[model samples]
Target: MPKALVTGAAGFIGFHLCRRLSAEGFEVVGLDAMTDYYDVSLKQARLDLLQGPDFSFVQGRVEEPGLLMRLFSEQRFDLVFHLAAQAGVRHSIEVPRDYLDSNIVGSFELLEAARAYPPRHLLLASTSSAYGANTEMPYRETMRADHQMSFYAATKKATEAMAHSYAHLFALPTTMFRFFTVYGPWGRPDMALFKFTRAILNGDPIDVYNFGDMKRDFTYIDNLVEALWRLAGQPPPPDGKSVCAEDSLSPVAPWRIVNIGNSQPVQLTDFIAAIEAATGRSADRNLIPMQPGDVPATWADTMLLTRLAGPITPIPVDKGVQCFVDWYREYYDC
Candidate 1:
């Protein structure tokens, strides 16, 4: 079995990825800081489940000095999935430094670690926020994402550029995927679906941002996990031609950026309806204006993924929301 290393293995997405990779015959090494970013218990629970014969968990922060370097030196990873990130749009407003520390500095450290010991394929998790201020509906990977709307987006965009430089100069085969608004079982508490579910379940009023007019390309976790697994083996080569046309695939370097999303933008109200339907409870919603550093909508033009993977993996919002609601109820015993 090939060796795989995934950072932020305790995170919702990372946890799912590690579990899938372990199931798919990879000797997985999972790393996480286990920080109280949202809920440490949840992170611990995610990590605890990964403890098995094929999995090894490393407890450490990615930004910590000499930590990743040591791990890289000790283990020759066939693939390195950097999923750990300081993720938040509004929180970045409160503490912009955290974004810089985790997203930029930590990514630099990972590139340095990879520089010393290169993996067969290095995948970085970017965000759709990197497509900041690009009003183009259904964000494509090749769009001009020069104007970042938030510090979090800036740091993530910086990581993409930094990774590209490493790929071009050091010959590191890199794949960067811009994730849409992902939600599902074991999802982040900071996200919309989880919060809405919790508030509705507890019979509390839920804040409907953008006056409930916003649209999100709500991606299910399983679809994202499948995309990552498929992309891990499809890194661009050094001699590949940059797709000059409008597409997400990289042209010059052995690095490409693709969007992983459901490709369907469901309205916030509709999303809540799904939650309400799933939980059998109508939510008391407090309509609010758009929060700062937030886009009115986010849609992913997953044409590249569709062409490559043959019809983008999609889980209907109703079904996906119900799955999450079920998991939330079971996990919290609500």
Candidate 2:
């Protein structure tokens, strides 16, 4: 079995990815800080489901001085999925230092380790927020994304540059996938879907940000994971040539950035309505202005992704919302 090291293995995306890798016959080692960012119990619960002969878990921060180096030396992972980071746009505004430590410095540590002990492919998780201040409707991979609206996005964007430099200098095969509002089973507590579900099920008001004017691509977890799995096999060629007209593959390095999203932006109000439909309970909506470090909209141009991987058929918002609500009811006994 191919060995894989997945950082941030307790996170929403990381947990699902670990499960997918194990199911695909990869011997997976998961590392997590178990930080109390949301609920440690929830993280533990996710970890509990991952215990098996093919999977192992380690608890530690990715920014630790030599933790990654030790793991790389020991495991010599065939594939390294770097999903660990300080997530949340609004939270980053309040705790910018955390973003620096986890996103930037943590990525540096991972890169340095990978440099010392190279992997076949290094996949890093980025966010659509990195496309901040771009007014374009469908965000293509080759577009210029110099302006970032939040510290969270700024740090993530910085990682893309950092990873590119490493790939150019060290000839590492790297892929940075930009996620757009991922949601589904085992989602983050701080995300809108989780918070809204809890509030609506409890007969409490849900905060509708941007006065319900915002829109998001809202890629489901399963779809995103599938895209990632397919992408792992489609690493950029070492020749540094474009794969397609819309490809973001760097001309000087075996590095590329792909947008993994639904490519269909849904209004925030419609998302809440999906939840209401799923729970059979009407939401008490509290219309609110957009928070600091929050964008009004996000849409992805997945042409490059389609060209690289095969066609991606994303789950509809209603179906994905229903799945989450069903899981929430069973998990929380609501």
Candidate 3:
């Protein structure tokens, strides 16, 4: 079996990917800092489900000096998934240093490690937030994303540049996938779906930002995981040849950026209605202005993703929200 090292293995996406990889017969080493960013217990619960013969867990931060180097030297990972980072746009306003440390510095550490002990394929998690101030209806990989509205987006964008340079010099096959508003079961507490479900079920008010006028592509976890799995096997060659014209493949390096999204942007109000229908309760909306560093919308241009991973059928927001509500009630005993 091939060996894989997944950073931030306890994170929402990392946890899901680790489970899928382990089940597919890969020897997976899962590392997480276990920080109290939101709820460490929730991360721990996710980690619990990943315990098995094919999986091993390490409690450490990716930015810890020499950590990735030692691990890379010993394991010689066939695949490296760098999914761990300080996530959240609003929170980035409160603590910009955390994003710099985890997203920027941590990614730099990973690139250095890969430079020394290169993996067959290296994938990093970026966000649609990296699109930043671009008002483009459907964000494509080839678009200019230099103007990041938030510190979080800036840090993520920095990582993409950092990884590309390494790929150029070291010949490492790198992929930077930008995820649109991801939501589903085992979702983070900081996300809108989880907060809305919890507040609605408990008869509390849900914060409806931008007066409920915001829109998001809202990709489901399962669909995102499937896209990731397909992309894992399809890494760019060092020669920089691409499969499509719209490919974001770097001209000088074996690196590319793909957007994984539903390709169907849903209104915030409609999303809340989905939660209300799923939980059989109505939300007490506390309508508010858009928070800092928040755009009114985010939609992904998934043409490259389809070309790279084949056709994709994304779950509707209603169905996805229903599944999440069901899991939330069962897990939290609401």
Candidate 4:
């Protein structure tokens, strides 16, 4: 079986991705810091489900000086998925140092490790927040992403640049995918869907940011994982050949960025409505101004993704919301 190393394997996306890789017959080694950003027990719960012969877990921070180097030297992973990071737009505002350490320095460590022990493909998770300040709808991978509204986004963008340089100088086959508001079962409590479900079920008011005026291309967890599975097999050509006119493949390096999103921006109010429908409860909507380091809207352009990995049909908002509620009700016995 092929070996894969997934950093941040206990995180929302990391947990789901590890499960997917394990199911696909990859011998997956998951490494997580298990930070108390939200709830460590929730992460431990995810890890519990991931325990198996094909999967092993390691507890440590990716930014630690020699952690990644040791793992890379030992495992020599065929595939390296760099998904570990301190994730939260609002939280980043309060603690910029976390983003700098985990997102930037951690990525640097991973790159150096990969440089020493090269993997066939290095896939890193980026956020749609990297598209900050771009008024353009349907964000494309080739678009100029110079202006970032949040410190979180700025650090993610910095990783993209850092990865590009490594890909150029070291010729590492790297793929960075930008995720747009991913939500589903086992989602993070900090995310809107989980918080909305919890609040609505408990008869508490859900805070609708931007006074329920914001829009997001909320990609479901399964759809995002499916896209990632396909992308893993379709790494950029080492010769730097473009797949099509819309290809974001670099001219000098075997590196590219793709937007994996639903491509349909849903209003924040409608998202809350989906939660209400799922839980059979009415949400006390607290319309509030947009938070700092937040954008009014975000949409993704997945043309390159489609051209590269075939079509990825997204799950509708209501249906996806229902799935999460069902999982929450069972997991929490609510």
What would the TM-scores of all predictions be? 0.98, 0.99, 0.99, 0.99
lDDT of 3 by residue, 234-319 (tens): 89877778888999999999999999999999999999999999999888999999999999999999999998899989898899
| Better model by lDDT: candidate 1 vs candidate 3 | 3
Candidate 4, superposed: residue stretches over 4 Å from native: none
lDDT string for model 4 (287-327, tens) is 89989999999999999999988998889999999999999
Query: What local lDDT does model 3 show for residue 11?
Result: 88
The whole-model C-alpha lDDT of candidate 4 against the native structure comes to 0.93
> Candidate 2, clashing residue pairs?
none
**Prediction 3 TM-score vs. true:** 0.99
Which pairs of residues collide in model 3?
A: none
Q: Write the per-residue lDDT of candidate 1 for residues 84-141, one digit (tens) a residue.
A: 9999999999999888989999999999999999999999999999999989897888
lDDT of 4 at 106: 97
Clashing pairs in 4: none
Q: Write the per-residue lDDT of candidate 2 for residues 27-110, one digit (tens) a residue.
A: 999999999999999999999999999999999999999999999999999999999999999899888999999999999999
Model 4 reaches what TM-score against the true structure? 0.99
**Local accuracy by lDDT, each model:** 0.91, 0.94, 0.93, 0.93
